[model samples]
Target: MANIRFHPNHDLLSHYACGELESASSIMISAHLDLCPHCRQKLASIEAEQASELEKSEPAALSPSLNAMMMEIMAQDCVDIPVLDEAPASQLALEDKAYPLPSILQRHNDKIGPWSRLPGNIKRAQVDVSGDSQMNFIYMDSDSALPEHTHQGQEITLVLAGEFYDENGTYQPGDFIVQTEKHKHLPRTRDGQDCLCLTLLNAPLHFTSGLATLLNPFSQLFFRR
Candidate 1:
């Protein structure tokens, strides 16, 4: 992902490395780690540091009886390790179009719901990642746009395929974007480009400007499946 312009911050990555994030958020970061070499390297460094600290910590001495018990267990015949069955690659299909999912998402294939229509030219497939937040696969058709909106809480979007642009800049595959209440922008693709994104929203989006404002009342559609 050479074109990736956005990424999870160090604090978020640190939390992910520490296994301190919620399951849904952890999956999001794990998928991003698959796409991002830089973040992967950073996470590796963080893990190494944590491992070093653990190694440096003093361990209590074991009693002779406990040590003898451990030795007796180790002396027993070892059982064979079971080989895991390899699963076929997973793909997300919409009509005739299909997109390969990241490894982390592939593991959750059963959790993905069917695609449903949304306002504008957008379509959404809810991902049943259990948490207080909502996760979805948001598909934007070519030349289509979502109305300008700001977040009620926090919103995170990771580009899975194609490209999209906002008032700020264009986002390519592997780009990790975060939005707060202070930001308001329309997200859309160019004439020949459609986009598939994985989005995690902690709260409903507040549609801004014109007729889109009326949509604010129904914003729960984005929050709920």
Candidate 2:
């Protein structure tokens, strides 16, 4: 069981209704919605809205050379590529835990694994990496400040450290937070054990400053998750 953090100013459940949730957001909402059926129906109503929107999108018209060119491109496809030691099907099934980010991340932040030193007081190690999603564990030194940044989608930050606060509130060990597009915060950890967190995000931080925006193009190619 996880402690619930509610926001009075923001109706976070509204994000669920807007279909703006990432994987982490979906899981959090699922558990909470299960406990509250009114929100569950709200989710259903949201789904219906998405369906209607999808039905109304204009389809793109393909160029006259599209089919023939696609056939030519496919005909030249190279074969005989083999991968070694793929992850087991069980691991890919995502049945391991309901709190996958928290469980996997907290266990490994105690010691380093692969992800290395990044700027600021943050050190990250990627644990679960697949095609569309990435799971990283972060450790922030006390008195460290991670610069203000926005995210490509949603992120689940599970505090495994002493305590950290942004414009929001302090997060301590066992505190799980879902950060969506609507939420942008600068975090800091001070006066205690190093703040460690499990951050599962769909994409990398999109720096939101004028100077940062100029550097965004490079970041997408290299710093992308």
Highest lDDT scorer: 1
Q: Please report the TM-score between candidate 2 and the true structure.
A: 0.51
The numbered model that scores best in TM-score is: 1
Instruction: Please provide, for model 1 over 125-207, each residue's C-alpha lDDT reduced to its tens digit, 9 standing for 90 to 100.
Output: 98998778999999999999998889999999999999999999999999999999999999989999999999999999998
Under the 3 Å rule for N, CA and C atoms, how many clashes does model 1 have? Answer: 0
- For model 1, where is the 10-residue window of minimal lDDT? 54-63
All candidates' TM-scores? 0.88, 0.51
lDDT of 2 by residue, 1-225 (tens): 244343211356667666666655554455344334455566677678777885566223446578567557757969898889633322111123222333222333343246577666677776544345566667777678776778878677766446688998877655557787888888887765467665667766777754556656776564454
Candidate 2, residue 207: CA error in Å? Answer: 1.5
RMSD of each: 3.2, 12.5
Minimum summed lDDT over a 10-residue window in model 2 is located at 90-99
Q: What are the lDDT figures for the candidates, one per model?
A: 0.89, 0.58
